[model samples]
Target: MATELNTPQNRVRFGEFEFDCITRELKKSGRVMRLEPQPAKVLSVLVHKAGEIVTRQELIRTVWGADTFVDFDQGLNYAIRRIRAALEDDADAPRFLETVPKLGYRLIALISSSPNSELEDANHTASLPSTTLPRLYWVAIGASVLILVLFLAGPAIISEFRRPSPQIAEPVSSIAVLPLRNLSADPEQEYFSDGMTDELITDLAKSNKLRVTSHTSVERYKNTRVPLPEIAKQLGVDAIIEGTVMRSAGRVRITVQLIDSRSDQHLWADSYERDLNDILKLQDEVATQIASKIGSHIISPTDARMAVRDVSSNPNKQPIRPLNIEAHDAYLKGRYWWHRRGTEAETRGLQFFQRAVDLDPTYAPAWAGIADSYAVMAHHGGLQANEAMPKAETAALKALALDDSLAEAHASLALIKFSYYWDYATADEEFRRAIELDPNYATAHHWYSHYLVFAGRFEQALSEIQIARQLDPYSVSINTWSALIYYYQGQYERSAAQFRSTLELDPAFGPFVADDLARVYEQQENYPEAIKEHQLEWTAAGRPKDGELLRNAFLAGGPDGYWRRRVSLLKPVGRSGIGSALQLALVYSHMRDREQTLRWLEYAYQEHSPWINFMARDPEFAWLRTEPQFENLESRIGLLASGTR
Candidate 1:
């Protein structure tokens, strides 16, 4: 029999399981199961009430607090799944967990404890509350796992324990290198200056001591009205680097400053003026100096060797004449607008890239920039991949033709291979090459994570995303994508919890994450929670997909006229858009309207809409799975019960 202990410090225990009410960690058989932070909290409550039934309403309020407006079931379900996975129980069978039907779940394991030890641990834990435990546990973990965990203590503790902590940046392990602004009056020579700024950031990224934010996030700060402290705070960086570029005739001059964000003090500053031929060496020297002043470790021989390959050192790359400054300026302009991510800005981005290439046809990076714009269009659904991919491929190939060492060009090509061709093998090759060329290329890690998820490699996917998270620690966009990976991997409860955490950081991401939460609830047969989340999501998106999906959740023939009206509104306008039609069929099928369901199902298959991939896994289609039409459709779509593709 496993020894049992209950202390004022410890909440409960059963068998080898221990729930430290204060710490919110579930240790089973003496091993920590890396539970996503929130689920660990929900489990803490359940462990305390082990023998008694925990009501759904009570659990929701306790886990999510009273002020939260969102539906809590998605979060609750995710918590249960994470806890269950940790317990190593079969989801389909029952041992420690017993679903009490409509009321709630009850933990069925018998708990036994020795009298003396239980009293001591409980007393130790009694001095702490659940909220305080998370921080204390993190401090313990951080002290062991990372040398600089104290810097992230406040933010990490709040995110983990769901309460605000001290407001201070941890010792900085991650930072953003903003572009060096051009102070020169000769606006025409701005490109040469901007190019130097970008090159310095690239050089510094090779240092493992710092995780640099991607160029997109840093570009938002250029020429902005925000103060350095505000910019650093918003980006969650401990320090910031600013610089200015000036060029006269054919020579270039650069000035740089490094600021300690917390104290608003200038840590280091430097000035450099050099000829066109010395530009590359100047950038490398600036990066080295900044690293030295900012307490970064000595640059490894690998980094030094790579920097030595600069064009300034290897004169054979370009002659020391007047540089093509206009082309470099155009490229910077393209990058500036590209980061804005709007439809019109995307169009302007292409114009800038084209102009850069026209002025300097041999400019490999400009071609890579064009490839990036096309890839963005494909990603945002503005252009179908078929149209966007060819242009992306062409531009990437051109960039590689001039500079095979260009990481961005490899990333652009890798995107096409992953998104369109579904060629995981080639996509892996391209991404690996991109990282090899520039180990600090965050996009390579981000995109490869998606490939890992779709290929059913969940552990690898998490590892890749962890690297991306290190690079873009404060990017709400990257965080949202991380949640999506959990959702697709059937880790709904974990996914839902992460999505909720993401929304706290970025309210604008709420609508999308809400829709995702509704999907998770519906899959779990939690209809009431599903409907409420769908309602919230529908209002936020103001889109037909959400409302239409919600309507399906309620179309169980209880109200015939209501079902008919909802169906009419949801039906797709055009015959070609079969995705919408599929939604209508699902609603009708649930409503017992067999004739309409079969009709739309036939139409969906014929249109080859991607929605057909859901047929085998969709809970809505559970009834239809035994039908001959379902088999035929599955066979035609090449979908199997096990994820075929």
Candidate 2:
């Protein structure tokens, strides 16, 4: 049955939204929505045919007409995606729109709360435009010659398929891959989706033509209700890639769409399905297609299509090898936990990585995960460096032996070499090699920046850290390093500003950077601001009483009393992040008690505090730079000769 609304009343309402066909306007709660002409036309057609199937070909003819030819499939899909975005609809469990597999689309939302609102004439709601109508100039042909005439039009029909898609736009130079939704509707499958997100980012980053935001950065938007343009702005990317992944039985399916961040327009969309065992090849294929669509990674659209076709025809193309699926699963689980960031999280990550290796001892990525987990554990205080560093080294070497091309393995190894072995030259080589292998690895840039800062190469460090920030702008650690490096270069004003900017950028990131900012204020001799920041830090650390006590001490006896009070409150170091010996050493350094400062430094060194390596770099220790014990300690750690290793 044909459906229609009162003419010029030419409007329909669904799910709190009202659409006017004549005006081509969509509004929610009286606020007009952005619905471009093309997408608006598509929506009008669907709304008029509410609760009915609109076949792909029928919609194409009605909307584009025979005279205005284009890549019909891509155009239609882009239009549908834009409409869905406007309606805030989900493809998997749509509220207003639904996809009819192998058929077309159906406007499933109740219109004007009536099912029998029908009057199907072409002009009922919004008549089809002339450009959308098919012309039949030779329709009077005789039956016997009709078949011959259609056969003669075969070339033209094929040519119709090659028309340029309207979705094409100016190529974007950068993009962020938001975490893919888990379409399995099972929480257990979240790891699979997250793992796929990481792999997609990794593969896309391989294109020198584009900058792919770090997975850690985009994961911040996984389930948040933030606006798309706002997310793009925060990520500082030209485009955004959002998608969904589903795994069923032994097969996996993924659907992704690219959007222009500036206009929130759907620029391109594609879907891929593959056997679970060949997921690696499937990921590479998807990445290649997306990269080509967004930049000059594949030269041109024609070249992109040919390259995809050649994946099967080209003998040089690598075949899809069977993966040790269980081991791969375990490795993914390891990564999922590793990103959680804490002593307990690292322990869980280590367990899963160990499980992966046990399942397949030669799985290089799994071994690399093991190395990373151990290395982080050391830094996070889950284990003493002396204990974790050796274990990290072993796993890193094993991963390297298995796959020397792995950028992640090289990075983990390089960090360990710098942090423990103090092999400055080798560490530099490894860091460069890791970046050369995968220039988009943000952690490599982040860590290398630290090395450069320690070596007093402030310009190089600033450049590397900025690159890291560009790749992972939302990463608290990466942002914090930029501030720290600035402080190391004696640019106190810049350092304080960076710290304050990072805090304002994400209040959730404030906790990680509050202490750093507090120290920066201390360097400025702004004791009041320093105390205020430290109090916030104490409160965030779940020590409100301690924060109040410190404030009271500052009120009573000024900076001297505050340091003395902190000295009394100092507790021996424990497992992980609690009760750092370095904090006490800094407090003693503030009091200018050389004997106490040296005593606490030795204690921090014994406890393997992650900050021990940078003891000499602490601004608070600047007054005691001439102390022999301090210089002797620096020499003992391989930082004496050139002050960096």
TM-score of 2: 0.75
Best by lDDT: 2
Q: Estimate, for each residue in 209-313, the C-alpha lDDT of model 1 and write its tens digit.
A: 776667666765777767777888877777788766656556665656566777665454545655654555566777777776665742432222112122334
TM agreement with the true structure for every prediction: 0.55, 0.75
Candidate 1 structure lDDT: 0.63
Tens digit of per-residue lDDT, candidate 2, span 328-397: 8998899898777777888998999999989887677888899998888888667887789899999998
How far in Å is the alpha carbon of 319 misplaced in model 1? 7.0
